[model samples]
Target: MRRGFLWDGFDAGIAAALAGDPDTARDHFERVLGEDPLAPGMVDAQEKTRELHALAADREAVAARVVHSCRSKPGLDPVRLAMS
Candidate 1:
């Protein structure tokens, strides 16, 4: 399912961010956003992604931070992590 793929991608991005791969995480987050900009938690994801992007133009930094934050957090559910 497209939704499933997006969710998985989101999860991966979060995981990647927590792992310190901001670039990869950013890419995944971007992909998820692109897939469903109107999704429930897409707005938040978009905001976070944008922040990460602004934090570092380099993709690596973005991914790293994203993964790190997601991993450290307790309520980062990809399915519920929409833009709404």
Candidate 2:
């Protein structure tokens, strides 16, 4: 059930991102993060949404990256990725 919420938040975030609503996506993803910070793909979603929000194109591509990261993260995170 918890995982359901996780993915719900994740999917909502991705949908919002793809719809060109980074702020909404961030809000959804924030719920996911609050539920489980260590959940798979969350860090990437957070980071991607942050950067994606600043741009104006390729929202689908950005959302794809976030989904991919959520699918598989090789130890990357918002803070570390942000720093680099």
Which candidate leads in TM-score?
Answer: 2
Q: Residue 1 of candidate 1: its Cα lDDT?
A: 21
lDDT of model number 2: 0.59
lDDT of 2 by residue, 34-64 (tens): 6644755766555654554443245756655
What is candidate 1's lDDT per residue for 1-84, written digit by digit as tens? 266466677677666665667787778767766765666677676677566545544545555565567776786543323221
Kindly state the number of residue pairs that clash in model 2: 1
Query: Cα RMSDs of all predictions?
Result: 9.3, 8.4
lDDT of 1: 0.62
Residue 83 shift from truth in candidate 1, angstroms: 28
Q: Candidate 2, clashing residue pairs? A: 41-70
- 7 Cα displacement, candidate 2 (Å): 0.4
Give each model's whole-structure lDDT: 0.62, 0.59
After superposition, the stretches of candidate 2 with alpha carbons farther than 4 Å from their true spots are 1-4, 37-61, 66-84
Residue 10, candidate 1: alpha-carbon lDDT:
65
Residue 66 in candidate 1, Cα distance off native in Å: 9.2
Estimate candidate 1's RMSD in Å: 9.3
- The true-versus-predicted C-alpha distance at residue 15 of model 1, in Å, is 0.9
Which runs of model 1 end up more than 4 angstroms from their true locations? 1-4, 37-84
